[model samples]
Target chain A: MTLALYVPRQSAVHRVPAGGKLLALAVLAVVLFAVPTLPVAAAGLLGVLLVGLGAARLPAASLARQARTVRWWLAGLFVFHALFSDLPTAAVTVLRLLALVLAAAVVTATTRVTEMVAVIEWLCAPLRVFGVRPARIGLVIAMALRFIPVLAERADRIREAQAARGGSARGLRGVRTTVTPLLVQLLQMAHTISEALDARGADDEPPARGRRSPVTAA
Target chain B: MKTKDLAYIALFAAIIAVLGTLPAVNIGPVPITAQTLGVMLAGGVLGARRGFLAVLLFLVLVAIGLPLLSSGAGGLAVFAGATAGYLYSWPVAAFVIGWLTERVWSRYTVVWGVLINVLGGMVVIYLIGVPVLAAVANLSLWEAIVSGAWPFLPGDAAKAFIAAAIADQVRRSYPVIERPQRELAGR
Candidate 1:
């Protein structure tokens, strides 16, 4: 599954550092919610489009697909608001959400996953005082990203195998049969992977010396 | 934590993502997904702390702008959106499930597991999810309860029961959660 939204491109938007892009996204979200007006929402929507399609040089289809994915939600949100509130309010809410969504798409499409992880590490650095290992967290995130496709494939295989075996599994029995085997496979892989990780020094890293580091510096 | 513990957490996080890839029914921003089953499984299989961390890790990845959430929903936008309350409730729900599961580890049964999941995965989620839905979407509490959560009750219950039964099978076959500290003390 090409699950990542990143689209490799060499443009000004892509050139923006991951942290900067993420910060801009945060600000856009705040401004939209803090002042929910039709003009502001419309501007935000247009601005995201210009940056994503014009400056970022991202394929229009890529962003369009994202909008399509949430089309139902968008429609429902709009209808609910219009019925409950008013047309102007509905337009403001919808535009605000659409702009935020597009801006986020631009950010994800422009930045690499590793770069995003680095930003998360920086954000979590403050937690180091509580003995949290940001690197370990990064490793877990990377591992999860790497393995999602693998697990999805395994799930497919399990369904296929069940199909081959007379297709009797249905409802609760079917779900149980599928999930039990899938989880068992994951657990077995975890056993071997842990051994590999230990050999690869995943556990040997020095602990975060939150308490001792200050003393040592003194 | 041991290397194996870290791997379990990461793998469980991956499991959540994989489950999200299953077909979803979208009504509002929050879709009906098998993803919460993975959340229940995490707590049931990894116990409290690790289960919480696994779900948290998956959510952080979503927040990192990966399209890991069901229906390709991810990023700070989703977190800031109306459905953000449900997302916020996930880790806590997983934690509560694991905490309850660990307490009943010795006498665990499919029935017990299902009850735990329903309480944590459904009840707890609705507790936080409805209020946030109301506040963010600017609907009344009754409107939020009627629109945001009511549509989700049956599907969530099915998922809760399925997750519990799956946890029971995993426990009997290839249990991942270690004996809790309390269990060790009692023994």
Candidate 2:
């Protein structure tokens, strides 16, 4: 659950707004797709390294680890292309992937989850026109994040109960038995949580005014 | 949405995340996961709008760097990869499944549920996902279909049946979806 890879550092990259970093990453993807040349891809890779290591002052290991994790996928992608296309095309594809992966790593490493979520809230602000409430969106997202572990724990309990019955929790039967109970439990819990929300005056509250999380209840 | 509506959607999103994190059912070398099944169940159980929003919220969490994807990978980088097509199709697929499920609510049976799941979860997913896979992975459409679409067909079919069965059970035990609100083609 501790999925945020943000490494606290004192650098200008850390100071850049999360929205800007996300926008840049998106533009980089479009650029790589549009150019589709080895030089541009290679330069993209180089620029990512420079910004990540030199300017951001992130450890080389951090970026290298991201690349290493995707090494097999990169190799397979290259091989797949080489088999169907040409060597240079494979090179560009792999390089393009590497650049995108590292660029994302750089952004993830530099920005906090809260900052990224704030950016998300800001982006969703325009969706308010369709009777969509941005504040409710934030609250629901936070609630989902908060409840994932609770549901996983409950799933474990259901599996254990099935195992106690000498039932296999591996095949389709296992899935049905396990998930149905899990889902039933979830619905019951949802009922309670909604009651809690009403009890706490959640409906009457204004959209969250700032970075404070709206979902304070467990 | 009411507080109950928000809770149901959020909880359904959590269920999808839980399914993604759980171990997959390995039929062969490839693992057949129930995360997609969760998508179908969300639509089947929650109806079109709420079901659509549940899956959308899950993706939003994924985009915001939660490790909710089956591969445990997250963040904006995944949006650029070859698998982006499948990722993009999820919310739409859920919506389609939910929309179909809502329409057939009056005559809803496990049989109808399976058909809706197959139409939305399998056919619709591949319809939108395969071409993007071909374009991004630089494979021919045939290659993409064979590699991207074929291996999962059997497993997905099985999942379709299972999802339909589970939805029927939920409908009987603790039905969350309301009666069909609109006529077919109304929305």
Best by lDDT: 1
Q: For each candidate, what is chain B's TM-score?
A: 0.95, 0.91
Q: Report model 1's TM-score to 2 decimal places.
A: 0.76
Among these predictions, the greatest TM-score belongs to 1
- How would you encode candidate 1's per-residue C-alpha lDDT over A1-218 as one tens digit per residue? 43357999889988888999988876777677778889999999999999999999999999897687557766876787798789998899778777876887788789887887788788888998998887777767767776776887777777788779877576887767665876788888987988998898988876555756666878
Candidate 2 residue-wise lDDT, B1-187, digit = tens: 8988889998989888877765554332123577888888889999888988999899887675554666444556567777788878878888999989888887889999999999999998888878988998889999888877888998899889989988988888888887754653476
True contacts kept of each: 0.65, 0.58
Per-model TM-score (chain A alone): 0.71, 0.68
What ranges in model 1 sit over 4 Å off?
A: A3-15, A24-112, A157-169, A207-218, B28-30, B181-187
Give every collision pair in model 2: none
- Per-residue CA lDDT of candidate 2, range A102-158, in tens? 887898889876777678788889998997777677778767866886876676777
